[model samples]
Structure formats: structure tokens, C-alpha cells
Target: MDGRLRVVIAEDAAIMREGLTQTLTRRGLDVVAAVADAQALRLAVEEHRPDVAIIDVRMPPSHTDEGMRAAREIHRDLPGVAVLVFSQYIETRSATELFAEQAGGVGYLLKDRVADVGEFVEAVSRVARGGTVLDPEVVRHLLGAARRADALSTLTPREREVLALIAQGHSNAAIAELLTITPGVVEKHVAAIFAKLGLAPSTGVNRRVVAALRYLGS
Candidate 1:
């Protein structure tokens, strides 16, 4: 928390870019650059040499896995830079693509997390510090893949409560409010869920959404 981390943010949406930048800045992290497209993201990373890159999982010109590809390149060219990916949905291929590069120093979280600036910033810091952070939603999707065997078995009752909230796309604060628990307690539950599912925190949320649909579809 003492040493500020340099960060580059890339999102195709303008409002999201601005909001994220302002939020990160308010949290005392240095947003070295903010861009709207994949090309701009590449250039921004090259120019800024940020310690971390907080990127949306999709961007133009194709708006399909562009951010994941850019992240791959950054992981290759800028090994020191971590990436935290945000997404509205989770698809299996997307998750495979992002982590296919390098799992370390990466994060995948749902866009809903943005509502809780405190938790979002904490996730950013975790990735910057070369630790993984995955949205518990992603973990539920992964665990759900286990079929009727009760995908929920991997967690304690408390963690199951957290995962159920996550599957509903609830924010940590929202989950805390619903359960009459503290956000910190929710975080512990989330951590437990992630460990049981073998999901790194940085697994992109969109990918998890895809996984969830697939798991739940059956």
C-alpha cells in the first residue's frame, strides 16, 4: 500500500475507461496510461512501462479477444507488467486465451466488482504484486463443471453462501449486506472457494460466465 504501482488501463468503452481511471487514481495508484483500443493499449504499455495493466477483456477493432491478445503480447514483451482483466461475461475460450499466456500476475474479475472500489483496488494490487485474484463467480463456474456431484461440495457452508452470491453476480459489499456479514469475511470465503476450485484470481470473468452457462445449461 505504501509504494504506488504504475498501471495502464485499456477498455473499448469510453465511460468505463474514464470511470476506472478516476477510481484507480482516487485509490492512490498511478494510472500511467488509459486507452480505448488494442493498438492504443500496445502503444500505451510501451510508452508507460506500467507495473500493471488493468484491461477490459474485449476491445476493437474486432472487439473479440483483442484485449486477451494484447495481454499475451504484453506478457511476452513486458514480462514485468501484470494484467487485471474485467469482463461482462465469461466464455471458456476467453479464459483459456488469457491464461494461456502466463497465469501469474494476472486477474479476471466481473465488471460488477467496480461498484466496490475498495475490493476492486485490492484486486488490482494483488495482480500488481504478482498474485492471482479471480472473481468468485469464475470459481463457481469452474467448480460447477463437476456435474451433479454437487459442485458446491468443495467449499464450506460459509463459502457456499459466498459462491452463491458470486454466481448471482453480486458485489462483495452487496453479498455482505445480504448475509449480514463483513466484506472481509466475504473475501475469506471467496479465497476459500478459489482454492477449492483451483481457479487463479486472475481468470477472466467473461470466460467464467461462458463456463457457468455451459455447466448450468446441462
Candidate 2:
């Protein structure tokens, strides 16, 4: 994953698609192909085998779940290719379904993120490098809707914030930087979150992913 990576975009809105293409190109990424529908997306990915694919949550014919289905297929068939599910609003079901049984090299971002070219590009790159990038709003919504809300009610506000950041795949250092707190304090919050949530100590499982699953009621 060196040099400018090849990208494939599948978005129905012409203006939005073109804008994305221009932005990625301007940022030194090569837009190998930009298509409008799920079929075209599959074809483009199969033909180009790009490093990353930016896909919408809906498109063309049915305009419902087509993009999501295509994204899942790409993730299955092209393990090396990173997929970013870009949408206007948070769809909890879609987000959970996309991450089901897998957590690496994936991202779910709101379209508003496109306004900040730096952040958007960094997200894409992070996904390309086998890292996860979840939208903060998505995390918030899931946290707010956690099953057995009482289970999460014990966490302090600051501890809850740390849990959400962990779910977003941010390291303690990154979380500290964003929250302007010392890394040691972040670790303390993380410990408090795990304890409050009653998550048993484990070595094989990712506690962050577990926290997210709890939020999503899984």
C-alpha cells in the first residue's frame, strides 16, 4: 500500500459522485473508475481490483440496500480491498450487518464528512491500511440505544466517551489527543468502562468490538 492508491467509487448522485472523484483526485488518489449502480460497482471492482472502494448505501434500480449488498460481496470476494460505506444518515441495521463477524479494513462514514477533505481522505487511507473508522454519530446512536440501558447507565459521562472512541478504533494515544487528556487517564476510563459494562476479562476477544456489539444489542 505505497504511493497513491487506486480507488473505485459507486454513487448514484452525479454531482456527489463527481465531487468525490474530483476531491480524491485532487488529493493524489487515482480514481480507477466511478460507477452509478451495484452491477457497475461489481464490474468495476472485478475489472480494476482497486485498493479501495467508496460505495453508497443505496443506488439505481431498487435504490435500497443494493450498495450494501455490493459492499458485502466485495468484502468477501476481495479480501485485500477496503470498503467504505458512505451514506447520508446512520442506518443501524446496515452498519451492524456490514460489520457482522468482521471488523478490519472497513469504514462507515456520513456524507457530511466529505466537506472536510483532510478527515475524509485520512479515513479512506486508514481503511485501506486494514484499520477501522466508524462515524462518531453512529457510535453515539448505538450507545444511546444500548440494550439493557441500565447496564451502561453506571458509566460516567467521560467513561462513556472513552468507550465510544474505543469502538471507533482510536488508540488510547489518539483518544487522549482528541479529548485533551493524558493517556494514563484514558486507560483508567477504559478500565472503568469495562468494569461498569461487566465485560469479563479476555485475551482472545477485542473488548472494543464487544462494547460496540453491546451497544448494538447483539
The lDDT values for all models are: 0.76, 0.85
TM-score winner among the candidates? 2
Which lDDT tens digits does candidate 2 get at residues 66-154? 89888988987798899999998676666776787478988989887556889899999999888899888877765555544677777
Q: What C-alpha lDDT, on a 0 to 100 scale, does residue 113 get in candidate 2? A: 53
Q: Model 2 segments beyond 4 Å from truth?
A: 144-218
Give the Å error, residue 152, model 2: 16
Scored against the true structure, residue 10 in model 2 reaches a CA lDDT of 97
Per-residue error for 95 in candidate 2, Å, reads: 1.4
Summarize candidate 1's per-residue lDDT along 132-192 as a digit string, tens digits: 8888887676555444224446567777666666777778899999999998988787766
Off by over 4 Å in 1: 142-218
Best by lDDT: 2
- Minimal lDDT window, size 10, model 2: 141-150
